[model samples]
Target: MSAPVLVFGWGNPSRGDDALGPLFVEAVEAMKLPGIECLTDFQLQVEHALDLRRRSRILFVDASGTARPPFEFQPIAAARDDSFTTHSVSPQSVLQVFEDLEGRPAPPSWLLAIRGDSWELGTAPAPSANANLRAAIAAFTAWLPDL
Candidate 1:
């Protein structure tokens, strides 16, 4: 059998909107899809790259602070200079690490970002952010069947 797909959700659960990534991963886990593995954590790291080596594909979910509006969810492919100096290692960097560690086939990868606000402790998402979360959940749910 082929290796399973990995869905990795990265973010801080203690921080308000930052938890969205993990939350989305939780939603995915609850679905219990066969041949897919779901992993959620506070952030991406070099260790995570090594852990994904056996998978055939990876879907990374996170909350980002780009120019896009709140709750924006988009799929991203690998790119040059993708390191995140402000946060944990970038997804692209992780993929690179995987390539270095394993000489064989590297898994296909994609990134999904949810626009977020209010990273303060004990705070909840604002109205707009909640709406975005709902949309993101819907979109992610729709993609689960095909995986």
Candidate 2:
């Protein structure tokens, strides 16, 4: 059977701070918890829509400059956007595509935003970014067991 929860994280690891999403994936994978599936990519593409299929719940993780603290979690609803036609789509757009293809509503989904400052090309995460990543991982570690 498919896992009940899917954690999908995407970001460019080579960019400073932008690696938060995929790093979060790595941490979660290490836990090897039951009924949870983890996925990571450089970016959210339209092809990723299929990942939502057969999931009971979904979490989309990324680094956000405007988000606060360790991380921010908010419910996501499937909604079609003009951007859906593009190759690189947002999590919401991916959900919309899932709905379109499956002819049904998507599972409950949340977007997890880990705060980050710099995301320059070809740089390691800054010290402050590492702090944020640690906090986010801790926060999710606590949250995951309850799911």
Candidate 3:
């Protein structure tokens, strides 16, 4: 059986601030929280829909260049948006694929977008981005108890 909650974080670790997503997953994994599973990827793909099965709640974490300072957390739903692709997709696109495969709506989901200012390849994550990541992780940890 799968965990009741799924936390999927995606981003390229080689890219400066883009590494926030995977870093978030790493932190969560270290927490060793029970009943929650964590996964990380360089980017979201259609295949991730399979991971959504048997999950009660899903949290998609990503580093966003346009997000507000610290972070942004908001509910999301399955939608046939332009972001759908086999190589790279959005959280909503993944949810849509899950629904398409299951013939029903996907589990409730939310996106936790951490603010990122730098994304250059082969560069270290920016201090500001790391700070934002810390804040986002703390918020998620607090929210998990109510899940």
Cα RMSD of all models vs. native, in order, equals: 2.8, 1.4, 1.0
Tens digits of per-residue lDDT for model 1, 1-147:
334888888888877888878887788778787887888888777777677866867888888766265455445544445464446788877777677678554577777788886788877765666676678878877776766
CA lDDT, every model vs. true structure: 0.74, 0.89, 0.93
Error of 2 at 124 (Å): 0.8
Shift in Å, residue 147, candidate 3: 1.1
The digit string of per-residue lDDT tens for model 3 on 1-147 reads 899999999999999999999999999999999999999999998889999999999999999999998999999999998887356788999999999999999999999999999989999999999999999988997998789
Q: Which pairs of residues clash in candidate 2, taking residues 3 or more apart in a chain or in different chains?
A: none
Show model 1 residue runs off by greater than 4 Å.
1-3, 70-87
The best candidate in terms of lDDT: 3
lDDT, model 3, position 45: 88
- Estimate the TM-score of every prediction: 0.83, 0.93, 0.96
Candidates sorted by TM-score, best first: 3, 2, 1
Quote the lDDT for 103 in model 3.
Answer: 100
